[model samples]
Target: MLTIHVVSHTHWDREWYLTFQQFRFRLVELIDQLLALLDADPDYRYFMLDGQAIVLEDYLEVRPERKEDVRRYAQEGRLLIGPWYILPDEFLVSPEATVRNLLIGERVCRRFGPKMRIGYLPDPFGHIGQMPQILRGFDIDAACLWRGVGEAPTELRWRAPDGSEVLLLHLRDSYSNAAWLPADENGFVQGLAELRDSLAPYATTSHVLAMQGTDHTRPRADLPRLLAAADARLEDTRVVHSTLPRYLAAVRDELGERESRLPVISGELRSSQRAHLLPGVLSTRMWIKQRNHACETLLERWAEPFSAIAAHLQPEILNLKPLVDRAWRYLLENHPHDSICGCSVDQVHREMVTRFDWCEQIGEEVTRRSLQAIVQQINATTPAIVVFNPSSSPRTDLVSVEIEPPPEPDQPLLDEAGRIVPYRTLGRRRREFFGMEVDRDGFAFLVAQFGSTGGRVQEQLTFRHAEIAVEEGTAHVHIVVSQREGARPGPFDEALEQAQALLTDESIQHYSVRVVEDEGVTIQFVARDVPPIGYTTYTLRVGATLAVAHAVAHAVAQKPVGATLAVAHDRATLAVAHKPVGATL
Candidate 1:
């Protein structure tokens, strides 16, 4: 007999085109009614809350009194709450962010009741390659997700990098399987038939996971009666109101008998997948992407380890966990499919930026506390900064510290034992201090191969920023002065001929002096004088060398608009314009 588990749910986006408050009004109503139905009617077997915990948070924010009502239902195995704090875009965040998201989900939902056992990521853009390992780390062994599956069957063994595997189900059409579910008995009969027929090919087992809701959907209070009516019209099928775990568990059994019939998909979920899940979103809104990386680095690389070490040293600060969790909540809020994917409306993204700012602020403050605690106990003799390797295991790496007594630009910096440290400038802040060489307290970046203790030195690294000055789209030539020049062709004419031949290539760094018709405006090509982040602007001025100026080739053709010609300081000035559309020049 065919068994169909009609999983009742609502795909809730806390904020999308509408603001959170606007969406909350609908969410509050939905949850209020859903809660009432689950309690008022004993027949309403179960209801799934969008495979997320944010809906719970949003619900509690407005209807704080109904906390137990929701929890009671969850504890009874009649409601599914998590697998995610918020349904995040799988591609836009770091693996650590995913781990933290699941951690928050598991932590919060456990307070209410038993959380959803499966990694029920129904709405992420695409699954990452390492998702199996991540889920397994959280002790979750299976996942049900939609998007990024091409012609493949819904059931597959998705493997991770570490060879760990997950039982994955990629929903074919959508999580909204029955969005246009029929209201009348006759319509419901036809709908069930069409749904059954439609799902036959994708079904390898006697069970099918049926989604009975759409985006921002309500609990469809009379779905149980409708399923009962639809079942009477069917001959051999058993239609029942059920949850995902119940359905997937049954399907898992069916698949076990017919193992070879299903496909095992390896690696990530991005490919010639059905809908493509709109892959462009990965690179969209790069400003947000860059900021996200920055904040994530601060939290994952610095703040977290620093806090862990601090907690190891001081047991008193353990109470800061709730505050840290709040910070993480804010950061995770920014991980929603639309929010962190950076494809939301301007208002939504603006709110996201503020959330990020909040996370960064808390992260910075926490990190500062940790550092202050570490640095305050230093017993160094000379000008040295106490540094800690945040890694748990023994590590010896290049350590950089900004010292108060700024060293001279060329002076070698040393440790407390008077050891001369070889270093390069990473950055310097021009603040004057009382004992500084330049009469200012500017901080100097002193990098060195410092051993953590008596261990081996490994992984020498430095952060360097270069300021290259080039006009947009313009190609540049660099000549190293120290490189021995080709023996200068002993004869003058041979040298001149050789120079002429070399000058033909635009990349050739041969000396070129164009006097602009010798109007006293000399243009020299200098490879040695470029500053960081500086640009060389080629302002064309009208001069006697009209033919020479006209022949100048640009990286991108810049046409002379109306030939605006003038002379400044005995120099030819030519005003060039950006390449105009449909213009050959």
Candidate 2:
């Protein structure tokens, strides 16, 4: 006879075909009903919260009074929440993001009660190769997933690239096998038999799992009673209500002596043998992918390491942990399976842009503040450029910086010991602008006026020989406008006439052209052997033999990791055809 462990749960996709709020409205309803059902029914032993902790936050945001009720169920082992913040697509986001998801998920879940320890990835489309190694860090020994593998048993040992292994429970008939059962005993028994028969071949042990859930599905309040009635009608199976952990424990006990004999699967699971892998999601909505990578790189590479360095050097002056944490939370919200996989509705991806912006803003601000704090500790007196290498290995690459008051074309860049360094001037530009103060209404009026006047205030002003210097204004600084070198026929005369009237009017004050003659030249030079995750100092010398020249060569440039030199084996002369005079390799 087959022994079936019927696990009741709901797979929640926060956003997909519907926007987040639209889906979240239904989420609130589902949770509210589930809470009431758990309160009334002692027979309802377990209900999984889709293997995510964020749903709790989503629910509590609307029903703040039911916080303790949630904590009660979670602590009582009745409602399973998390092993992940969100069930993300394993391939789209970075590995660091996945780790952060786990870390934040566990942390958030522990705030209410104990988190589900199993690595529950029921609907991730596929799985990663290094997932076993990642789960090992959290001491998660079991993973239940549905996709990304060839023909395999319901239970197997999944080994990572690092040789780390986890007990894998394959949902042979998908997570929704027993999702919406019939009300009658005969229908329930027939469905249970079919589910058992399908999963029996894959089951190495007598205990087979029947996940009773699907995407955004509500928990079946009558599942426990139906199982009880079906147990009496079923001829060859004994069905019982169970949780994921309980199901895994039973399977483990069933395979106690012969656990090692279970089938072993390794690496990434992207097979489409049984389920649709949907590989095209990787390339779709590429802008979302690009922005995600950009934000991740900013936080992981620049903001995080530099902030740590600053805090270590000046703990009293800087504590950026909170800001960095906030940034990560914002970024992680975009890593969900449908959202990051680029398969969600247009509104869903559109909302992701704002989160990305917030993440980037926080990261950039923290980086600026951290760098300023670190620079305060430096003892250098003369004006010098600080080149920071955020990489682990020593690097000898060309670095570029813009110097104000334009360094002379003949002046050579110098190292710390006053040694001449080879350098080239890329370009030089003179920048100037103005500033002013205005109120909110005045700001809006100016914006409207600018729009009405053809959105080319700069072009209009440039043609009038009086170039505007500010584009927009803040509440504290009103009427700040700027313009660049462009000429077109517009309401230039009208704008100039209004400006003349305003100059004579008594209300407009602090109207000044704060010209900043930033005639800076952008210079590039090879910074040799910059220390790993450290900084190097460089300066410009007034008088030195210019070792660098901007000569255009007609030779092909080969891409190499570092400086490469080719030697002739037998006194062979290097020849260059159609090369510029004074050009050398």
List the candidates' TM-scores in order: 0.70, 0.79
lDDT of 1 by residue, 442-468 (tens): 111101111121111122211111111
Which portions of model 1 show Cα errors greater than 4 Å? 257-261, 317-320, 387-402, 405-412, 422-585
lDDT of each: 0.65, 0.78
Error of 2 at 409 (Å): 4.6
* Candidate with best lDDT: 2
Encode model 2's per-residue lDDT on 1-585: one tens digit a residue.
Answer: 788898888899988999989999999999999998998999988899988999999989999999999999999999999989988998988999899999999998998888898999978879999999999999899898988876888999999999999999988778899876777878887888888888888788888888888888887887878899878888778889998999888889889978787888989998889888889999899999899999999998889999999999999878999999999999988988899989988999999999999999999999999888877788876667888888888888878788876554345566887664556667756554545455444544654665466534443233222334333331122222224232223334555454444444445443443223225778777788988888888876553432322221111244233323343434232222212222122
For the record, the alpha-carbon RMSD of candidate 2 to the native fold, in angstroms, is: 13.4
Q: Using alpha carbons, what is the TM-score of model 1?
A: 0.70
* lDDT accuracy of residue 173 in candidate 1: 62
Give me the candidate number with maximum TM-score: 2
Query: Among all windows of ten consecutive residues in candidate 2, which has the lowest summed lDDT?
Result: 546-555
lDDT of 2 at 9: 88
